[model samples]
Target: MTKSYVVRYVGGPLDGRVDTLPDLPDEPRSTVTHVHLHEGPKIVHHYDLCYAVEYGCEYRLRADADAE
Candidate 1:
């Protein structure tokens, strides 16, 4: 049997504390994992970086096991 879960992201100015999203596609489920900055390309520029830093860049996505 396959297990399901809800992925919630804690980000943006609103804090996204109450925001939650469901994962689709039953074949494969989504899971959260840590990523290094060097692993991906740098997209944030001067303004974007400053805004993100000032507002706090602590967006954490947690997967909560769904109750079946």
Candidate 2:
């Protein structure tokens, strides 16, 4: 199976520095294995996009779909 996702810093200046969206992890488990993607989400984004998947968290991503 395939999935979409993104990765971002835990909490820093680059925090929420989304760009790598729609990442298909080799296996989506409690811990991610790899993240070999860095592109915008597959949607009409407006502002910025990012995701967080660390420190006891799931693959939560953010995008600006409001923009066209």
Candidate 3:
């Protein structure tokens, strides 16, 4: 099984506390970690880096998130 997670980041004018959601950037600020999970178990393995979006453009923003 494969799942996707939206990587949230705290940068730009919004630092310290996160009271509102941040806007997406224009280029990749960090490595985007894709993952794959087995059917028998819920454990997931780190897959690859999504360098570009569907439109072939790179997103610019650091993603700070840990899997649960």
**Best candidate, TM-score:** 2
Candidate 1 displacement at residue 40 in angstroms? 14
In candidate 1, stretches whose alpha carbon ends up further than 4 angstroms from where it belongs are 1-7, 11-23, 27-30, 38-68
In candidate 3, what are the lDDT values of residues 1-68, reduced to their tens digit? 44333443233222222222243445534443334356775542222223445423332334435723
* TM-scores for candidates 1 onward, in order: 0.20, 0.25, 0.21
Order of the predicted models by lDDT, top scorer first: 2, 3, 1
Q: Which candidate ranks first by lDDT, i.e. highest?
A: 2
Taken over the whole model, the C-alpha lDDT of each candidate is: 0.34, 0.39, 0.36
1 or 2, which is superior by lDDT? 2
Among residues 3 or more apart in sequence or in different chains, the pairs in candidate 1 whose N, CA or C atoms overlap within 3 Å are none
Ranking by TM-score: 2, 3, 1
Candidate 2 to native Cα RMSD, angstroms? 13.4
lDDT tens digits by residue: candidate 2, 36-67: 33486433222222333353233333332554
In the range 1-68, model 1's lDDT, one tens digit per residue, is: 54433333353322344323353335432333433356678332111111134332224443233523
| Ten contiguous residues minimizing lDDT sum, candidate 2 | 43-52
- Quote the positional error of residue 28 for candidate 2 in Å: 7.3
Q: Residue 65 of candidate 2: its Cα lDDT?
A: 50
RMSD of 1: 15.5
Candidate 1 backbone overlaps, count? 0
